[model samples]
Target: MTSIPPTDFRSFLSSVGRVFAVFFRQGRKARRTRFFFLFSFLPVAVSLVIKFNQVFSGKPGREGGYLFTNLIMLFYLQMIILILALFYGTSVCSEELEGKTLAYLITRPIPKAAIVLGKYAAYMAVMTGMVILGLIFSFFVLNVDRLLDPSLYGLLGRYLGVLILGLMAYGAFFTFLGSSLKRSIFFGLLFSFGWENVIQYFPGSTQRLAIAHYLKSFLPATSSGRFSFLTFRLEPTKPGLALLMLFAIAAAFLALACLFFSKKEYSLED
Candidate 1:
C-alpha cells in the first residue's frame, strides 16, 4: 500500500500567508495602485472644498442640496470603483503573465482557483478601503455642523449599500473581461462610460440591463430629482426590488468571472 504524506494545516496557513505577502509586495511596486488612491481622493476633496465654501457663506441649505446631489451622483465612488476594478481585476492575472511569474506560482502545489480568488479578494479589499476613506471624508465635509436628519442619514445608508453592490458587480464583470481580453482596460472604459451610460437612457426593460439603473433607484427620490435629466425619468424601484436586483447582478457577474477563469488558458505573450 502506498502511504500518503500527512497534509499539514499549519503548512496550508503558511501558504495562504505567502499568497497575501506576495500580493502586498506586488501592490507596493505597482505605481498604478498608488495613482488609483490619489485620483480616487481628488474628486472627494474638490467636492468638500466647494461644500465648505457654501457653508461659510451662510448658504447651509445650498450646502445641504449640494451634498445631496453630490452623494447621489457619487461620481467619486463610482469612478474610483470602476477604474480600480478594471485595472486590478485584469492586471492581477495579466501582470503575472506579462512578467512570466505566473508559471512559478502555478507550479506550486496550489490550485489555480486559489490564485485567482486570493488576488480578487485583495483587489476588492484595497478598492473598498479607498472608497470608504473617501466616504468618510465626504461625510466630515458635509456634516461639519454635526446635525443629522433621519431622512438624510437613511438616504446616505441606502446609497452606501448600493455603492458596495455596484463595486461587486462591476469588479466581477471586469474581472471576467480581463480573463477574456488582452485589451480589457480600453474595452472596460468604453462599456462603463459609453454603453452603460448610453443604455440607461433607453426605455423600459432595456434600461434594467445596466447595473447603474438599479443603483440609482436606491437613492432617495428627492436626490433623483437633481439628475432627472440623466436618469431614465422613470419611477425608482422599491427598496426591496432595488436590493434584490443589485445582489442578482453581483451574483451573475461573479459566476461568469469564475467560469471564465476556471477554463481559460492564461498566456504571457499575448
Candidate 2:
C-alpha cells in the first residue's frame, strides 16, 4: 500500500487559499462591481426617504403603505440580484475566456469545478452583503417611529429565504448561459425583461414556468393599501411548496451549469 505524503494536506490547504484569493482579487478588479454596489444601495436610500416623509406626515394609510413598501423594496432588491448575477456569473468564466487567462488557471492542479465554485461563492458573498445592507436600511426606514411587529419579523425571515433561493436559481442559470454563449448579455437581458416579464402575467399554471411566480407567492401582500392594484396577482402557495419549488429550480439550474462548465471548450478567440 502506498502511503500518502504529509505534503498532501499542506497542498490542499494552499490550493483552497489560492482559490479564495483569486476569486476576491478578480472580482474586485471587475468594472461592474462598483455598479453592483451602487444600484444595490440606491433603492434602500430612496425607500428610507419615502418612509421618513410618510411617518412625519402621519398619512401612511392611502397606498397600503406597509404592503407597498415591502413589495417595492423586495421587487427592487430582486431585480438588483438578478441583474448583478447575470453580469457577474457570465463574466466569471466569460471574462477569463475573453482575456485568454483561462488556460493558465486550468493548468493549475485545481479542478475547474473549484474555480467555478470559488467564484460563485465570492459572488454570492457580495450579493448577500448587498441584500443585508438593503434589508438593514429598509428596516430602519420602516421601523424608525415604531417597533417591528413580531409577525413582520417572521414574514421577513420567509422573504430572506426566498430571496436566497431566487439568487441561486438566477445565478446558476446565468452562469451556464455565460459559459455557453459569447453573447450571453444580450440573451440574459431578453430573458429578464422579455421572458420573465411576460410569463409572470400569464394566467394559472403557466406562470409556474417562471421563477418570479414562486417568489411572488412567498411575499406577503402589500399592507400599505395604496397599491391595491399591484397586489400579488397569483394565489399564495403553501410555504412548504413554495420553498420546495424554489430549491428544486435552484438545484436543477446549478447542476446543469456545472455539467456545461465541466465539458465546454472556452476560447478567447470567440
lDDT of 2: 0.69
For every model shown, what is its TM-score relative to the native structure?
0.81, 0.82
Candidate 1 lDDT over 1-270, as tens digits, reads 965355755555556566667786676567877888787776577667777687677765545545645542556444666777778877766777677887788888865655665666677767777776776666656666655656656655665676676777777777777767778889999988888777777787778777777777775555344444545454566778977877777566656666676678876675
Q: For candidate 2, write residues 1-270 as lDDT tens digits.
A: 997587975665566567768787766666676777777777667666677677778886433236324544555534777787788777767777888888888898976766776676677667776666666566556665554456656655665666676677777778778777889989998888788777876787887887777777766665445443333466566768977887787667666666676788765675
How high a TM-score does candidate 2 get?
A: 0.82
Q: For model 1, what is the alpha-carbon lDDT of residue 143?
A: 63
lDDT at residue 164 of model 2 (Cα atoms): 72
